[model samples]
Target: MQPSHNDQQVDLANTAGDLVPANPSTFSDDDTLSGLEKGPSTTVSSPKIPIPEPADVAEKEPFLYSLRTHKYFITVTILLSLFTDMVTYGIIIPIMPSILEHMGGDSTKTGVLVAVYAAGIMSSSPIFGVLSDKMSSRRKPMIIGLTGLLIATIIFMFAQVYWLLIVARFFQGVSGGAVWTLGLALMTDSFGADEMGIQMGKALIGHTMGMLGGPPIGGLLHDAFGPKAPFYFCLAFAALVIVMLSLLIEVRGDEMQEIRKYAVELRARDLANGIEVKEVVHTSLWKLVTTPRMIAAVTVTTLEAFDLSSLEPTLPYYLKDRFNLTEGQIGLVFIAFTLPTIVSPLAGWVSDRYGAKILCCCAVISAGCFMLVLSIENKPLWGIVLTLVGIGLSTSSFIAPILGEISAVVRRTGDKAAYARAFAIFNIAFSFGMLIGPIIAGYIYHGLGFKWNCITTACILFAFVPIIFFWMGDRKAKMEDVAMYEREEEERKRILAEIAIIKAEKKAAGEA
Candidate 1:
């Protein structure tokens, strides 16, 4: 008869069981067996010991394997969602001033439009994060958000007034939050811990490509067609994503259930093997928000965002005023800021091997120093471009490592629910930073001068260096402790094996 798969598994399990001592001396009631008989038993048992039947082994359909095979389809859908979301975001940048002016608004009001959109995204991020976690379903949220974004884009395309455009932008921001956060969560669920970093790095490549491609395309579309052209294109892309999602199976369905089941089974096995499994309980967002490391990471991210946003809006104007550069020249200079995108995957790989804290601290500090240098120099355009490239490189090096560090720390603390909450807090902080950046830069430049404002911003960024150093030290100490524990565990296992062998010899003597 052909053996069933379960029968094969049972045979393997029984074989493993027979190889180990059934009655070791270490687990005996008494160890006084020195004078026991040492010969094999003469009497043969009438009936053999009943091995567990293969038919009794539970049989269920495999979920994880199926999901793994379908990962590409899921990843592509997510990428498309991210691409459309970024396109919508980038399209507004070049046209913000023009859009506002067409409706009889000033540059300050246009700046408010940017702030409001950021604020909306920040506000909605945590809410969607919690919902995604609770539902454990990325598909519903993604589809709903993409649909909303499509509607918002259509509204913006035909918007004739500033208020109408602001409303559309606000909804777009809300949808944007869903697209980014859910896409990340979905990717994390799809990949294992080690692969997650690489997958996320690859995913960010798409975003970087979008950043590189979207604005230029939007600008060209705006110049050739009209301000409405970008939104129309966005609307079509959003529709394509919606249709793509409909065809793909939901990634977080039975696959996640299987993963959870496997985790439980592993936990049970560890218990059987006398290993302690740490129990992790879901905690409130407020409790997670109070963690010092989480707070520090969030704060640093926020400050970085504020510094970036402040520069983004004014950089073009600054170059125009200081260097008398045309729009195309300014665009070329902006491209330098994005040059780090190409190297970010490599930076992520290195950070995974070395550690994120060191990379983060160096990136922030070096970027600050370079910003100071850029502020002092009256160099040629290429020199300025190089300085901006340095900034981009520093920023990219910091990003993946910082994010990986935050996720690692949160997981170590056994607070899975806190992941999205922490991410939300990070976004909110980033938004606040964005708000502060443009406002501060505007005030500083107007009240004092360009050089002094740049100097102050650079100084502020440098201040994070010492704070990050201390945090890095703490993280290193924790890592050392983990390594020590693992070594001790290995030693304990060796001791247990020796004890088992001694017990088995005693049992053999007693049986003989």
Candidate 2:
């Protein structure tokens, strides 16, 4: 006959217990008295050791996964990194005019400096994305990027030559691309698909803050102290990020084990579904570029960037010429334009719940009409401010929803590794828009007039609405399906768990 399971455990424990001192050297007189009181012939039995049942053991065994546990911390760290990068980029914007003057260059050369930085970002982003997705680890690329930011900050701080300054800006852009790609990809990995939009929105808050505060602080510090003051601030900020990242972020051995398990599970699932998991040699580049969802995301990014960059060069002039506004008034107008971005979190939350189709379409149309209206003659300052505010609010919906949509598509397609490259495409589109928008606006404003530039931009903005309507509408349905799939999967898992528990109980009863 077979020994019972408890008997097996008892025998094993007795064998191991022999290694423990039978009567420890420190055994007390109280034990001797008790033994004597129990009488000589009677042996004292070891306290009955309670062996935990299998189901209890399984229930009590904790999940040792770290990625999900530390997701919020990771998100904060990425946001801080992004904030530092943006601050580094923006710190010099207000001081660029002065810097250019000192170097015997004009505003056009300053524009060249900006363009070169953007060009660097555009060129390096795809490469960074490819490297990140190909690599098993995201931390290495992120660290390298932060190091580049540090080097760029040093260059900007001490460089007396214009060409050196240009080189510094280029490096800065390269670093920005790395952070944007890897950071967003990391966030995607950390969270579920449905939570991505709100998470992106939260990350964007850091960016908006950096943009809002950097220039003003730099300008103020420059006025109060010196040009190098802003660089010093940026340098300190970057250094802090590097240190914080090095200390706070690490994928432990346990996390790596879990990640390997996760990959294996994904591969098994793909095989079960008759989908071929790609080898390392397989390239998703073509697939990424050709996806209609990705095209829509890039298009939205480009148009948004165009609208933003087009305004940067022309808005101040429009306000000055149209209303004779002072510098302070122009600053107020800029604030009014950006103030609506504060509601971006709300937009993201809404997108996550209700889908982004109506929001994206309405935003573009509203922005276009507002732009057309802004071109009207003899508009009051308040009216212009209101119109700009409307434009800002409308445009704020594009980033999070579009990104969430792309992530959803990639996830549905089982190309989870493509997130980094997808965002790299976004960076390219944004950089391209930044490059082309001003050039086109400048040309049109020169060839035609300010009103014509507005007319043209408005028309272009309105055109994208239909594209959004047709493409972005499916997001809600897909999300619903994903939710249903998750629920069904959970139910299946629950049934399996119950069966296993029942089997364990029956096996123990049969042994009895």
Candidate 3:
């Protein structure tokens, strides 16, 4: 037990040699050393470790991936921005008349205040659209737009003069054009055509809520506190959104590289699947926009906006005159119009599953029919509400489908990069519709009556059906685009696998 020091050292060395293994080759087959070799057999217990697939990983930890994280965050951020914009704009509606009356401004001036915003949007949308596409990154334009919104909110909060208010509204319009045009472009770019309908439908909910809740919230705030209360609240809201945009939104600067990487991956996947990747031919933006298909989609959107704007301004007046209804009753009629729009996402889902052409055509025809019926003299209150609800349902189909169609067409035409401009054109068209609808409806109502105005609008809506049928083609091309996109995604995964293999080999060599 008490051996000499040299004897103890010899005994320790013998124990260490036994633990180390007599032959290094004996340890090569160990489970812990599986990846140490360039080509290790997985016939042992390695398969039991249960490695996860990419999709499973992505699903389990979406936030860990940059692409998924950015997409989800941006989608929510844009919706909130849209909601904030709408609420801010709407809140002013209930209070504007009072403020104008206090300042001794006439009804004409109030109309101008409303119309000027649309004018600003109409003028700025196209310019911003072109600029976004040309810019290195979309984030700059988005930030600039949000900054404009903040500045406009500050002006609304502090400015007492009517001219300053008008100026502030113009700024707000410019900001709106930027946000909608650039935001939509970003959405289209990020999500692609396949998912656009649902994404748009979801985003539209924010717009609807803003439109529905803005005036009431604004009125309550103004009534409870003071004129400054709504503005101050909106200013704080805008500031918060701006901070969110600055911190959270990320637009990859090297978008071309990313796209090419995706394309390469797709190519590799196609090779594995025994498919071919064909070179695609793209059309010029001008040629693309001027096409019958593009025109029809744009016209559908414009007419939809026209119908809504025309109805909104005239409804209260008509309700007041016909039913001798109080403000509360008039508000209920507006709800009837808005309630159908709640199902807009369902319309989008349907359009995505089926096609936009038939849906849009049917929507236009139905809306026109309802518009004609709504003009009936001495119509019952229930009948009027039903017609309004029908109109809302039909109109709800217009936006998501048309926007989806535009995205599809742009992708089909090979102008995959021009969605921003295309949607910008859409924004411009909508702005024009908004600007003219109320004014034209008012003029007709003054000259002829509400019935004549409805008649004219119905005619315009009816004209869209034939155009849609003739211009908007079948869904064959869209299916092809989807195939192409999926192939590319597969190629991306294949390339990633090769990269992983190479890295693994290098790591194994280093360890050896």
Candidate 4:
């Protein structure tokens, strides 16, 4: 009455997940790990044989492995790269007026320079994004970009003519494109999409610092050591960034790769499960761009940028004329506008907990209202500063939420999400907004006074708030997203479980 050996073979094949099916002699070598072996011939199932912990198959730790893998270290290194990129961009500001005069250029040429830099960012970001995704590493592109910045700095230092200056600015702009694209993509790779808001907020602190501090530092250096000094200052930072990046490790390359692969395999097995399995999702670029939520995210980023950059050209003049404030004083007032944004980390934290809708809606509304306050006539300087600060604070809503949302959209593309491309779109939108804002604001300010201009911008902000809040978030969508995230978490645990078994079998085989 005993079953034949062939019956046992077929029964084990059915229950063991996947049987070798081939003759056992083919795997007769002692090294044939049981990962490819039958689970067991009995009903209880084979004892869990493989459990690969972090200790198994992990790349050997390199010098400063802990430092390289630390979240804070990754954040700070990116922060310095962003700071250096912005500093190089801004550090030339104080010197531009005098330096341009020597080259027979006027304010109009300066505007051209600004536009060109923005153009460079707009045009080059997508390329960097593609390159980043193709190369599958942020370190190389970042180093190349920073090195390009150093070369641009050298050009700026020696340029004596208007055309040479233009070339240098464009080069700097190209460098800016690479830095922003690769830097942001790197951050996305290092951190989870859920935590993107806070991470982006922290990284942007470098941007704010560069913007606020760059001109002052440039002015001081110019005063003491001439036009070359700011560029010289930038050179030192560039070298430091290069060194820092040299020490930088792409931990995701080593760590998440195997897990992701296992996740993909499991996803294939559960075809209805909707886990993204590609290492790089090949979703058409336009397909992503056309998504409603993606549009909303891009709109928020562009509008926020347009509103902020609009002030750059018009606000200083308004401050100078209305209050008889000196350039130094005007700079101080603008500082108030930027200072509120220093709390972006908190803003990002809020975004992670509650979603981007409420934050973005409230922020835009507050910005519109505060902008209306700015249009009020004869306000005291303190009131103006406070209003600017309020506007700045309102702007904070866009930073983390939009960033997180973009990454979320990419994540939904499943495993093949190309973060670099998604953020490249973001970078282009922002650059476009920055490029056009001043032009539009100048026309409005001249034609209709600052009042209508604020009113016009406020109206635009008003229109988008609903889209941000309602289109981006709702009861049904929120529930769906929650469920999806839970599913993803469960799948992650399952993938880890599989990893455990696979690694454990290999270990057991080695011992046997």
> TM-score: which candidate is best?
4
- For candidate 3, write residues 416-489 as lDDT tens digits: 45667787888888777777886777667756777888899999888767888777634653454344334333
Q: List ranges where model 1 is wrong by over 4 Å.
A: 1-80, 104-107, 209-214, 247-251, 256-280, 320-329, 377-379, 446-449, 472-512
State which candidate, 3 or 4, has the greater TM-score. 4
* 1 versus 4: better lDDT goes to: 4
- For model 4, how big is the CA root-mean-square deviation? 11.5
Residue lDDT tens for model 1, 371-455? 7877874777778889878876766565555555555444443344455555666566666776667677766665665667668
Q: Write the per-residue lDDT of candidate 2 for residues 1-512, one digit (tens) a residue.
A: 32221221100101111111121221223223122122222223233223334653243322432332365556677778777876776566556656776788643555566566667779889999888765655666888898898888888788889999989889998998887787777766555555667878777666654644455566667777776887888878777767655654333222333334334443444456454333322226666656565677777888877776666546655665678754344545666555776766776777787777777777778878888987886777788778877877777767777777666555433334566887788788877876677667766765676788888889898887777777563544445524522432332232233334444665677832
Full-model lDDT for every candidate: 0.58, 0.62, 0.63, 0.66
Per-residue lDDT of 1-512 in model 4, one digit per residue for the tens? Answer: 32211111000111112210122222223211111112111112122224345456454667766676567777888888888887776565445556776676543455566556677788899899877765546878889989998998898788888888888888887888888888887787666545667888898777766655565566667777766778888899989988988897775453245444444344444444443232222555786677677788888888887787666656655765677654445556656755776778887877776777777888888898988888898888898888888887888656677777776666555423377888889889888876777667767876777787788888888888767765564333333333433334333344555655555565768942
In model 1, what are the clashing residue pairs, if there are any? Answer: 25-503, 37-512, 306-433
Lowest summed lDDT across 10 adjacent residues in model 3 is found at: 6-15
TM-score of 3: 0.74
Off by over 4 Å in 4: 1-51, 54-59, 91-96, 102-108, 216-226, 255-281, 317-328, 444-453, 474-512
Query: For model 3, what is the C-alpha lDDT against the true structure?
Result: 0.63
TM-score of 1: 0.72
Rank by lDDT (best first)? 4, 3, 2, 1
**Between the candidate structures 1 and 3, which one is better when assessed by TM-score?**
3
Candidate 4 clashes between residue pairs 3 or more apart in a chain or in different chains = 50-500, 50-501, 50-504, 50-505, 51-500, 51-504, 52-500, 276-415, 281-416
CA RMSD for every model?
Answer: 12.8, 17.8, 16.2, 11.5
TM-score of each: 0.72, 0.72, 0.74, 0.78
Residue pairs in collision within model 3: 265-491, 265-492, 266-488, 266-491, 266-492, 269-491
| Model 4 TM-score relative to the real fold | 0.78
Give the candidates in order of TM-score, highest first: 4, 3, 2, 1
